[model samples]
Target chain A: MNRHLLAALGLGLIAGPALAADGIGAGLLKSQCIGCHAIAKPENTSLDRLWERKGPDLYYAGSKFNKPWLEKWLQNPVRIRPAGELYARHVKGGTKEDVVDESGMAPHPKLPKADAEAVAEALMALVAPAELVSKGAFKGEKVSMAMGGMFFGKLRGCGACHMAKPGFGGASGAELYTAGERLQGDYIYSYIKNPQQFDPRIWMPTLNLAEPDLQRLTGYILQLGATEAK
Target chain B: MMTNSRQLASTFSLAGLALASCFMLPANAAAADEQYAKAARNYDTYCAQCHGINRNGRGINSRDMSVQPRDHTDAKGMGDIPENEILKVIKEGGLAVNKSVLMPAWGNVMSDTEIREMAAYLRHVCNCGSGK
Candidate 1:
């Protein structure tokens, strides 16, 4: 079966207010979720580039997801984007090449149920950027993210890891060349901080970068789907 | 005429029985020996230090290991894990891409061919299969 389908089976534990009550649940979050998703109130977008490249950002999850939907998804994830994860290759392309087996998505086998509930609560409260994205509204050709996209897709070789544009690359991992259309920036950041926790063995490597570089990388990645490509 | 016929029939039956036993006995003995020899060598090199000679989860390093190794003789636990997964673990090491860090990375230390052989040994020695 597809890795996404296998992952969906175990995502049921990530529901609303996962972190509000603290105690054992908080401990579970520390060991399990913090490895990937951020626990500190969102601040520097520094560590956002080093994540698993699969799954969306949970940084401002409160704003982007409906409480009910978040709860439902935490308990049973669905295929929001049929393509695969967002950052599998850590590049503009989000390649489909290296996406490995998905049977690894078993619930934190050692985590307790009460803690799982508390983690859900904490996550449900996450809402970083409350602003709406103004993409297709037409900011016009005055500013061309195309140069950035080109640097991202070819010059920097982000396409080698992520999905390639049109026909240039293979699908060893996730699909990203068009992420501007799908993902939020905060979520992108979260994926970068810790990838293994999201899905133990993502195709990407752990580059161990500092915060500022992380933000600059995020800026580049989030521009994947810029409306006004030059 | 009756006595001659009886002796000939008796001789034929005895020879046929002896030939059949000779063919069957060696095949069975060789199969058992081959399986045992393979597992014995595997246990000595890869497992005996950690699992002990008895397969009782008490190797020399067992005391130092934080997460105690799984008892291979546990029919229930071994059944849950598939053979291929075990083979993968053995080849890649416990900490390789898919398993725990405590298990250590075996890819650099052991060949893929060796890993498969070790897995077969586990199946033969522990009788651990996917089925409970």
Candidate 2:
């Protein structure tokens, strides 16, 4: 009788808090988020469905986003994509076009501190396929901003679309200026290596970079996040 | 698939309208408007960051870049470079024309027809070439 009672107590001690924490986070996500955000990758990936998307894909949040950043970012959500998700939809021009349209279409709603943590927990649970992320392994090489900047801008022409530093480069793509802080280095390497793998028919071109280019670029992006970007 | 098809159709229609304008007929006023509107849209998407939305070389990024992007609004400057040169520069990038390395080759992203349209649009903005 004593052994049975002890086993029950132990099971409650372990599973109680763990289940409660994860359950609350999952519950919050289901109620408040699934309306706009996708917790699961869609089965149909046609261009129409891509256009219909409201928020960036969070299905791979577990692998793509860092937990701490997710928590902090949720508390005060900000626009990351410069031209909004679908550039064609949000952009316009006129006599006085004021054309930058840097403040992407609609700002993401922010969450309170505690809610942010819970949502982050739920978000971080959304991991990508192991095969993809497993292929990525960041060496964390320390590359100088000058060298990486040259590779990104002059050689590869990335500066034409993406910002290397805040407000310093072009604005069509997501500014990886804060890449290290905002993402896992492995995810950055994997995504840069093959963006279309993540989202087929997306605008990011295939650079067909080899080993060093991939490593160097990933290292540089990580370094970019470590820089003074907010 | 559906949206891509729609965009492709829209592009073809706009191209046909642009072709009409090349002959100076413009088909109808609405079609001509659509062509220019698309030109403006493309410009806003690709070139405006460094070249300035006003096409006056005061783009938001201009303050930081060492080499200033060309002002499409400058008639004399745009006229000096032949329209063919503009097309080549846009398609092959500045390095091809011994211009600033900052200019990336849009050939990877934009269609040849789109690049041709962009060159013509530059002429329109500068009030040179057929725009005169």
The worst-scoring run of ten residues by lDDT in candidate 1 chain B lies at B100-109
Candidate 1 residues B67-100, lDDT tens each?
Answer: 5556677767777778767876665546443544
**Residue B78 C-alpha lDDT in model 1:** 73
User: Taking the candidates in order, what DockQ does each have?
Assistant: 0.01, 0.12
RMSD of each: 19.8, 12.1
Provide the TM-score of the second chain in candidate 2: 0.73
lDDT of 2: 0.75
Task: Report the lDDT tens digits of candidate 1 across residue range A1-230.
Answer: 67877576555344324424355545655677776565554344322242332334555554433444344445554333222343222212113112223443323233344544565566655555333222222222232356655644433434433543443333333455555444555555455544433433333433333565445455665564454221
Fnat of each candidate: 0.00, 0.15
Q: How well does candidate 2 score on lDDT at residue A136?
A: 51
Candidate 1: docking tier: incorrect
lDDT of 2 by residue, B1-132 (tens): 999999999999999988877777645655656868766766765677567667887654455555778888999888899767788888777878989877766666567888888888888788877532
**How does model 2 score by TM-score?**
0.65
Q: Poorest 10 consecutive residues of model 1 chain A by lDDT?
A: A89-98
